[model samples]
Target: GNQSGIPYSRGFECFDERFLGKPLVYCGTLGTIPVEVGGRPSERKEIEVGDWVVMCGGRIGKDGIHGATFSSEELRTESPAQAVQIGDPLTQRKLYEFILEARDTGLFRCITDNGAGGISCSFGEMGKYSGGCECELEGAPVKYEGLQPWEVLVSEAQERMTLAVQPEQRAAFEALAKQRDVEVAFMGTFNDSGYFTVKQEGMVVASLDMNFLYEDGCPTLDMPAVWKAPTVEAPVVPETADFSEVILALLSDLNLCSREYKSRMYDGEVKGLSVVKPFVGSQADVPSDATVLRVDYKSDRGAVLAEGINPWYSDIDTYAMTTSVIDEAVRRVIAVGGDLDRIAILDNFCWPDPVESEKTPDGAFKMAQLVRSCKALYDLTTLYKTPAVSGKDSCKNDSTRGGKKISIPPTLLISAVGQMVDVNQAVTMPFKAVDDMIYVIGETKAELGASSYYRWLAEQQGAAEAIGGQVPEVNGEQALSIYRAMNGATRQELLQSATTPTKGGLALALALATVGSGKGAEVDLSAISEGAVTALFSESNSRFLVSVKPDDAAVFESLFAGLPLILIGRVNAGEVLTIHGLATLDRETMRNRFKATLQGV
Candidate 1:
C-alpha cells in the first residue's frame, strides 16, 4: 500500500460493453474533510468591488491544453499524450490543508476548483457575479518556462484552486501560504470594469465584455425536431406450459445476469463504513438495491448511493426514458433506508456530437434528443422536489475508423444520493425469514417498449425492427406516495427486505431475491391482476417487492393504506421458485444461468 491517504476506488458497468471492445477500467480518488460550520450558514470570500485573484497549488504547464474543448469532441486515436494530465493527490493535499488554514483566517473571499477550462473558466465564473476580472498572464507561473501567453492563461494543469482575496489581505495570505509550504501567486484582479481583460507584458492580449462573453456572444439555434413514435405489438403470446425453460432463457441473458465477478474487483469494505455494501446476503455476493455508506459511525446518519440508466429506452421515447431512469434511481434508493425528502441526483448524459458536420449526418436529430431528455429531467425532478446538484454532458461519442462510422446510443446516467436516517435501519433485498409475506407496492402495466424481455424476444425472432410497445411513464404523485410508505415501513423494522423490479421486471426481481436469500417463493399472479402476462413481465414504473413477516402483515397493510399494494406471495424454505399459472424454476440452476454471461471474465 502507498499510504498516500488517497483511496483508489473502482466501478463496474455492464452497459459500457455496448460501446467499447473491452471492460471499462474506471478509477477515482476519494477524500473526506470535516465541514467546520456554525449555525449561521457557512460563508466564503465575498467578492467586493476590488479583490486580487490568486492561484494555488502547482505551476501551469502545457499539459492538458484545450482540455475542455477536447472533451466536447470524440476521442481521437492519435490524441496527444499531453492532453490528459495525471493528478498529484499529495500536492493537492498540501493545498487542501493550506486552504482550510487560510479559510479560518478569513483572508480569502471565495474559492473555486481550477478544473476543465483552467483559470479562464474558474476566474470568469467567480468574478461574473461581481464586476469582472483582469488577468496579468506574464505573472503566472509555468513549468520549465517557455510557455506562450495563451498557454499560461488556459493550461488545464492538475491539482489547482483559484481564490479571490481582498486587496488588503493579499500580502497576509501570501505570507500564510509560504508558512504552510503552499505555492501561491497573485496574477489577476477583480474589478467593476465590466470586461474580462487578459494582458501579457503590459500589452492587452485579449479583452471581452463580461456580459457579452458570458451571455450574448453565444447565439441560440432554432433547432428542428421530428418525433416519430414507433409502433409495436408485444408478441401476443400465450402462457408457457413449462416455466423453467422460459425462466432459464431470461436468466442467461447478458443484462439479466449477475455482475458479481466484475463488482468483486472493488474493495467495498476498505473504510469499514459500508452498512450495506455493493453486494450483500449470506454469500455476500448478491446485488444490494442502494449502497449505504456510513457517514458517521458514531452517529447513525449515513448516505446512500444508487444509479439507474436505460439507454435502450431512449431509442423510441427519449423524454419518457429520462423520467423512467430518474424514477428507477429514486426507487432503488428508497428500497434501502433512503428517504425521499433528502434525495438529490446527478445526471450524466452521453450522446453523439449534435453539431452538424460532414461526419455527423443526423446531428440535428441527436441534438433534439438531448434537448428533450433535459426537459424531462427538469420536469420530473421539479415535480418530485428532488434537485439535481450537478451534471455532465458528453456530446462527442461518435467516432470513425477506416471510414466506417461507429456511434453509441443516446444514454443518460441518473445517480442519486440520499440521507439514511440510521445505519441500523438499512435494509437489503433478501427475504429475512421464511414464511414472510411478499407484497407488490405499485400497479403493473403493459409498458415493455424498451424492456430487456422485448430485446431478447426481438433478437430471438429476428424481427427487432418490427417490435414496439409502450414505454414506462412516471406519475410523480403516485411514486411519492409509494416511496413514503416503503421508506417509513423500512425504518419501523416492519419490512424484512425490499426491492423494486427493474431490467427483468417482477420475475427477475423475485428470482434475484430467492437466489440471494438461498430461499424459495410461491407467488400467485392472480392476487395482483387478472392479466397474468402483463402482471408477470411488464417493466412498469414505481413498483417494489416488499417482504413483511406474517405477524406484521396487518401493520404493513395499514402502512400502505390507500396505496396500491397487494399480498402476492410468501418466502419459503423450498428450493424451487413457483409462480402460479406461470413458471416453476429451480433456484441453483437459475443462479448459475444468471452468472453464465460473466463467467471467467
Candidate 2:
C-alpha cells in the first residue's frame, strides 16, 4: 500500500542462439502518481476553452514515421526503416529536469508525454479534456526541410512533451524555457467548437468532428478464435547423472549462468540510494533475487523490485506458466524483506498472432494458450490481492520467409513492486555466517516439465526433447501464509539470508548461496525428500532456501510452525560444499563453472 513507489529495470536477458527478423528490445519504467500536484488534483484536467496548447522539447523528424501504425501491423519483408525512433539521452535528461521544474512551478495545467503517434495523437487526446482544438501545423519546428504537413503532424520525434497552459503564463513559461535551453512552441489553442481543426499557412488542411474521431472513426473488427489444446511429445526420462556434474552443467548454461559481465555496465547506484544492489555478495558477482532501494534521504522507507519470466513453460501449460511467474515475482520480493500485502504487479505479453488466416492455419491453439494465460492472470492476481496497475501486449511476433515460419514461445514477464517499513531489515541472498542453519521453506514435488534441468539433460543426451514431467502449479493460499511468516521472521531479525529456488532449483540455489558467501555448506536431502533428483532440481513454486543462525533456530521454527519447512543443512567453514553421502565440490571450482559461459561479454 505504498503511495509513492517507483519501478526500474532489475535484470538483463542474455541469448546464445540466433533468431529470425530483428532483435526484440524491451524497456519498462513505472512510477506512482500523486493524488495532487501543485495544489491541484492530478487526475482532473483543467483545460479551458481559451488555454494554449504547447509543444516542448525536441523538433520534428522523419525518422519515426508510422511508429504507431507499424506496431499494430504484422512484420513483413517491406517493413519501413523509418519506424524505429532514435533516442537522445542528453536532451531527454534535460527535458526531464525541466518538466520537474515546470511541475513544481505550476507552469502547466495538464501534461502528457509525446510518444506513440506524436502530435496527432497527443493533441487529439488532450482535445477531449476541452471540447476540441485548433492546431497550426506551420508553427512546428522541424529538423530538416521538405517535410509535408501531414508528416509534421504525425512524426514520432523523441524527447518531447505536450502541455496545456493558460494564456497569461505564456511569457513566464517562455522565459523559463529559454533559461533552461529547451525548445517550446505554441502550436494550437483549446476551443469548444466540437471539432479538431488543423491549418497550415492560414489554409485549412484537415477538420473532423471530435465525436466521430474519438468514437466512430474506426470500424469494428470481428476476429474468429477457436480453442484446441496442442499436443507435444513426452520426453523420455534419462538416467540421473551425478549431482555434482548436473549442478556444474546447469551453472554453465547460457540462461542459468552469471550475467555480471553485462550487468556491471549499467549504473545501479546512480542516485546513491540503492540499499541492496543488483549484485550482492562477498565477490559482488552473484545475482540478487530482488533489489532494495531507499526511497529518499529523508526517510527509512524502502522499495523492492523483482521480475519473473519463463517462456519455455508456455510450451506445456500457459496457465501454469502464468501462475508460476507471478509466484516467482512475489517470492523474490519476500526474499528481500517485502510483504504480500503491499505488492503490486505488471504484465507484458509477447505472443504470435492468433487469427484464423492463411499464414497461420494453426492459430486456434495459440489463441487458446493466450486465453488460458489470461484466465490464470485473473485468478492469481485476485487471490493474491495484488492489483495490476498497467500492462501491454504485442500480438504479431512471428516471422515467415521462404515458406518457413518461426514463432517465439509465448512470453509473459511479470514485474513486482512493493514497499517495506524499514530499509535496515532488508537481507541479501547469501550465507551471513558459518554454522548458520539452512532450511527449505516449501514442499518440492516431481514437477520438472520445461525446467532448466530437463532442458540441460536433453542437450546432454543429444535429444531435441525439451519438455517433460509436470509444469509446476502455484498454491496461492499456502504461498501467502509463508510470505507473511517470512516477513514476521525478517522483522524479528531471525534470518541471516534468503533466496528462492528458481530456474536451476535447489542445487543451483545452494551453489549460488555458497558462491555469494565465499563459504561451503554441509547439506543432507534425506530429511527433505527421498529422491535426489526431485529434491535438487524440481522447479516447484513458492519455495525458498533460507539461512538462520543456530541460536535463533527455536524462535524461527516457532514462527513458521504450520508452514511446509524442514531444516536440512548447516553452513560450514570448509572450502568444499559437502552434500552428505551425495557429492562434494570445491567452492572455487563451482564459482569458475558459473562464470565461464558469459565471462567476456
Candidate 3:
C-alpha cells in the first residue's frame, strides 16, 4: 500500500517496499476546477437544460498506480469516492455526437478522451509531448451541484475529453456543438510558459513547475551479486537400441516443447496486416531461417526475430551462450520470410551488479562473448547489407530471498529486424499441402556438448561427462552465399519455415506446422547425416526447416550453390512423421508428447 502509516504532519512517508532505496514518486499538480455560466432561459441557458457538461480532472486522492505514486494504495483509498461519477450511456452518446459535430467545424487541433487519473495524467502527458504549455482552469464546467473550488478541480468525473483549438476556430466549434444541443466553453489557452496554472474566476489557485511535476523520482540501483548453481544429477547412457527412443523422449519433454499457447494472445489481425497468425494447424511454427511479415498487397516485407541465451548457462560457459544467442536470433528471422542480408539487431542485457568486483568480472565474460558474437552477426549482416539498429540493457536483477541474496542467470535477449523489397511474397510456418519437399537448409554438425538434450536427458542418466566439447565454427562465406541465392531465386516458393534454437529445435519446427492450416505433415529425416542428428533434433542454433516446391529444387540449389542446403525429404500427404529412416508416428503422438512434457509429467 502507498499510504504512510506514519502521519504526514511529522514529515513521515510510507516507504516503497519494492524500490526500498528509491526516491519518492514526486507530485506534479494539485486539484483545480473551472465552470461556464450564461445563455438564454429556454433553449441556451447557463449550464444548458440538457447540455452535456464536460469535466476533466477531479480525482480526490493521490495519483493512480504506475502514475506519480508508489504502490496500489492510492487507488484503494476511500477519500476521493465522492467526486467520481459515470454519465448515463444515452447522455454520453449524445455528448459524443455533439463532439463529432464540432470536429466537422474544424475547431480542434487535437482531441483526447480523459482516462485513468482523469485530466491530470492525460493533460500532463499531452503537455509533455507538446512542449509544455499553460492551461487555464477558469472556464471548465463542473457537476458537484455544490463543491469547493479545489474539490471541483480534482473530481474524477467521467465522459470528459480535452481538446486543443486555435483562437480563430473556438467560436465555430462552440457554435457547432450548440447546434447539436451540446454545451461548449473556452477553458484556457496554450501558453509558452513552463508552468501549469490553475485559477478560480480571476484568482490563481495552484501553480507548479513542469520539470518538478514530471520527473520520476526512483534512483538507479547497483544491484548486488548472489547466485548459486543448482545441483544437477548426471544423465544415464542408454544402450544403442534405445538411443532413438531417448532422443524422442527429449523432444517430447515439456521444457523443450513449443510456445504456441503463449503467442496466440497477441491480436495479430487488428490492423488486417498479419499474414501469418501465431498459431497454425498441426505443423510446428518453426520456419526455415527467418520469420517474415508482409504489410500490404505490395512486395516489400518486414521480419522480426527474438533470441536469448540462458544466463545460468553463461555463468558456466560464456562463449557458448553468446554464440548460441547470435546463431538463434539470425536463424529465427530467416526461418519465416526474412532477408538475412538486410537484418538489424537489438540487444537487451540483464545481469547482476556491475560494480561488485566478483560479480563485475562475471558479467565481463558474458560481455566479451556478446562482443564476439555481435561482431560475427554484424559482419554477416553487413555482407548482406543488414545493419545493427537500436538496443537497450536492463541490468541488476539481483534480489534478497529467505535471508540470502539471489541473482538471476546472466541472460541476454536479442531481437533482429529485417526487411525485403516485396511484402506480398513473405512466407509463413504451416504445411500448405501434402507432397511438399521438406528441406534442411544449413550444415548440422555433431555439436551436442552444451545442448539442452545432454543437460536435461543425458545428464539425468549419469552421463554428465558426455557434455563437454567445443562447438564447431560456422562457415560465414558459405552461409552468406546460400542466403543470397535464397533471396535471388525465382519460382522458389516456401510453404512453411521457422527457426530452431535453444531447447526445442525440431519440436518448434513441428509446432510451427500447426499454425495457419491444420493439414499435418510427414517428414523423412533419413537424408541428414548421423553426426547432424543430435543438432537437428535438439534445439541447436543456425538451422531452419522449410517446405519447398519439388520442381523449384534446382532453382533453390542454384541460388544456394555455395551454402549447405540439404534436401532431406518430402512432406508426405499424411499425419505421421518418419525419422532415422524407420520409426514412424502420427500427429496425435507428436501433439501429445509436446503437451505432456509441459506439465512436468
Query: Number of the top candidate by lDDT?
Result: 2
**Runs in model 1 with CA error above 4 Å?**
1-40, 43-45, 74-81, 104-107, 138-143, 167-182, 201-203, 231-252, 355-361, 463-467, 529-533
Clashes counted in candidate 1 amount to 3
Arrange candidates by lDDT, descending: 2, 1, 3
Name every residue pair that clashes in candidate 2: none
Better of 1 and 3 by lDDT: 1
Clashing pairs in 1: 45-109, 45-110, 232-468
RMSD of 3: 12.5
Query: For residues 1-601, what per-residue lDDT tens digits would candidate 2 score against the true structure?
Result: 0111222337767352222532455566745456789777888877888889899998899988898777666677888888888777667777877877887788888888888889988898899889899989889979999999889988898989999988888888888899888999999899989998999998999998999889898899666656655565545665555788878888899999988887766677666778888898899888999988887788888989998899888878899999999999999999999977999999998887777688888787788889899999999999999998777888777776676777777788998998989999998898879999999999898888888988777776676465666889998899989999999999999889999999988989888999899888999987767778778888999999999999999999999899999998999887888887666878889899999899887
Estimated TM-score per prediction? 0.88, 0.95, 0.59
- Candidate 1 lDDT, 248-353, residue by residue in tens: 8888777777778876654566656778877777776668888887775687887888888888888777898999999999999999879899998888887877
- Of 1 and 3, the candidate ahead on TM-score is 1
Question: Which runs in model 2 stand beyond 4 Å of their true positions?
Answer: 1-9, 14-22, 32-35
- Point out the worst 10-residue segment of candidate 3 by lDDT: 1-10
**Deviation from native of the Cα of residue 165 in model 1, angstroms:** 3.1
